[model samples]
Target: MDPTHADLERFCAELKAMWEACGPPVLTSVEKYGGPKKSQVSTILNGDITTVPDIDNVAAILKACLANARAKGLEPPANAEFDYWKGRLGSLTRARSNHSEPGPAGNPWRDLAGTHPVWESTTDREFFRPRVVKAAAHLFDRRRRAATVLAGDDWLDETLAQRMTDRMGDLLTGRLASPAIRFGGVEASLIVLAPLLHQVRVAESAAALIGVRPIELRPSASAGPLRSDYERFLAGSEQSRLVARTELTGVPGRTGAKNEIGWWLFHQWVMRRQDPVPTATAPHDLPIAEEPLRTVLAGTLDRLVKLFHLSPDGLRNKERRNLVHKVSHPSITPALQDVRELLVGLLLVTAHKLAVELTALPSTIVEHLGIPNPVDLGRLRALLTGMTWQPLEVIGIGLYAQCHHEAVLEALLAHVRQTDAVLGSVRDVATDRVHLEPLLRLPPRASADFVTPAPHPDNHTRPAFVVPVTRFRIDETRVRELLMGEQLYSDRSLAIRELYQNALDACRYKQARHRYRAALEDT
Candidate 1:
């Protein structure tokens, strides 16, 4: 075995031992600077070595492990222990020259590759998380829009729309618990999206979903010559919006008329008997209202269909496309690179849709609430939404890294965060919205980090309140009798005498203290 690879493996093994002894902390809890992402840290703990580990990342993991140990009441590792690990890392770093660069290999769908460089904290979120979220959001939005328009005059299917909204929230926030949505892989995207795609029924509301009417695209001699096909297609009143959407999709074939867009939308990329399959299942019988519009739409539809790699007869070939259906159904022996390509393409399309569409609008709760500060309202919405999606997005980032590296599945379980814990945070924020409103508006720490409420203090039994003994007693009856002045003089006289004695005692006590202080000064 290569010396560097061997040393790297040994380092990983020892690191794992340390983790088990300290704790495989919830990876996110490890506080370190300039460290590898939690997912990479997780891989290290699992002894899945591909590249030379960063020393700072290694030190951070060790530090976190030690911190966890200290929290658990274990004795702190001595300086010598730290020095030993540091020495190991130093040796591994020096031997790094002998190690060959890593590349992709493994199960096409799940295994994380070794070649994918470790993600930094910020870059992880920037690359792939937003794309998955935005895709799901846009796709969910399009479905809702289609439902309202196509359900016709009698359409009152609020239930379907609500379910879709909830499902979208659940998926985005990582509350939904299914393997299909867990990994943020192409399979996961396809699985989460497949049902909604079927529900859209593109033929019935093609015009509405496409967002532009067929008649609106009528050829005009008044329109000036264009330098590019894109300019020609977008020439008109809605040209600005169309140009923006095109950039958003990143798919050149996306800009087209209702029928043309609808054709692509209708085809569902699905898992059939555990194999990837693309079927023209959604009906495409939308009628062309005008003959001239119909002729124009047909040609446009043909061109887009051809551009997207579908046969004229609606048959799909085993070629790379927007959806990952290249593998023959039930066959698992395909090249890893091909699988990676399919996933990348699918994700890119979804992410592009997310970027173009209005994905970051406030949730309905945020919109309806009577929050005064725009900043507070916006931040609260982000907190609620980010809590839901961040966990899943992290996993998506890992998958994106893996595919990008062209590597196979490593330890995917390592990437999973406490999603339930995350959703619980969302619930906490929503339930405490009334209480949180004031905090949300406060300045100079307005968006201070929120802590989840601890269990009620009342849950455990404690000592009861202690009542103090009476320092004095009120003689209400005597006072009333005295006030009347009709009582015998002897009884009134006794009460008055007692009050006088108490007053004299207090004055004398003060006089004595004063005299004593004077006497001490004289001495």
Candidate 2:
């Protein structure tokens, strides 16, 4: 109705904290500073007023507090604090007016059907229950419409009809009125009704496509539940009388028991009818029909390059393989196999690009880039020789000829050997030298050698070696400075209000849980 007594008390406590934190200046000093007297401030802070304080008085007190904060070198209160209080005051004023007026007839609390069992508090129940009830009612109405269509064919047997009647009666009279039927239960029951409605709709669509004669097939004495009827329709095992009564004249396949009647009819009418092909130039660039397939392929390639550091071997690791499977769509079983081949192809392409770039480098640059140490040169050659194009054959088999594969493999090997020879020659030269140290050092002609840079005066000023240090602790002096500072008052009150509201909400939640638990114990 209005701001509750507890809410007002909480607001007063927050106001007092803000005032005290601002130095709680003497009442005479506040009066001298063009603000209300100390007694008025105390009355406001102590929640002594019969009504909420005037906005002007509140503003004056805040201004005085700001003055006190500035005088003490503390941060002044923020404008946001004033704005928050202004909004609260408005709400309280409106609520007070509403409290004096008569309420509507129905009890909002009793009318609420706690349909969602997951509701953590009474407030959530009150807020969400009505919305859930409306949605369920909408679904129920749609289900009945579908039922009416099915009833024309005499599909509604006596037992099935009675079951639907009872369920609808329970929904309208009992569950809708009772507070016990939670959102979860209502949702679950709706799911149970969905399949029956879906089957009926599918049957109607299939019958229309096949151009079957309309027969008023009612439920016979031998009819079972709606679930059974739906199962029969889906399985294509329903009686021959329910199947397409007309000859499937143009349709090719002979009717069989194994095939579902609706699916057969749909396949004949829809699947067999092809639309004209588009004349657009880039037909091959059409979007993938399966979104998950594209997503998995893109993600796999990205992760293979970035996360796995472009290492083809990393793709074969158990962890990476498992991740691929985990993200793959369950419907696409060959997704993993396709990913493996594509990853191998991508790796080969990357290797080919690298080889081409390396071979393009001038012989002078390549010689200068050679490994200086014999041990390093030996390792380089071993690594290069180990690079084989055997895996590319898996991708190139039908995609490319054997001769082309061999030619590409030979080119890759030639590049590796040429690079290895450059390193080997450098290693030999370094070994033959009387002093290898000079070869390892930067040449005297280098720019770095010509320009001598001065060292930084402070070790801490050097970016390479400098490390940052931070210490955290509560300081009253700093806090006071902050309170008196200009930025202090801005967002402080809004934050405190939110925190206070959350605390009150948490209390209500615990109370609701306690009540729920007690109810469970009683039952």
Which residue ranges in model 1 land beyond 4 Å of their true spot? 31-34, 76-82, 98-523
Model 1 RMSD, rounded to 1 decimal: 27.8
Worst 10 residues of 1 by lDDT: 402-411
> What CA RMSD would candidate 2 show?
36.8
Q: Write one digit per residue (lDDT tens) for candidate 1, span 1-523.
A: 4544565776687678767777555687654545678888888877687777777777777778777887896654322144446555554553353122321121111111111111111122333333334433443444444433432211112122223333333333433333332232222333233333333433233323223323233344443432132234445333333323323334443432332222211211111012222233221222323343233323323222222222212222233223322332122113121122232222222222111111112122212222221112222222222222122222232111111000011111111222222222223332444422211211111111122221222232431122233434455446755675546455777768877999999999999999999999999
Task: Report per-prediction Cα RMSD to one decimal.
Answer: 27.8, 36.8
Candidate 2: misplaced stretches above 4 Å?
1-3, 32-35, 77-80, 101-523
lDDT of each: 0.35, 0.36
TM-score of each: 0.19, 0.21
Question: What is the lDDT for 261 in model 1?
Answer: 25
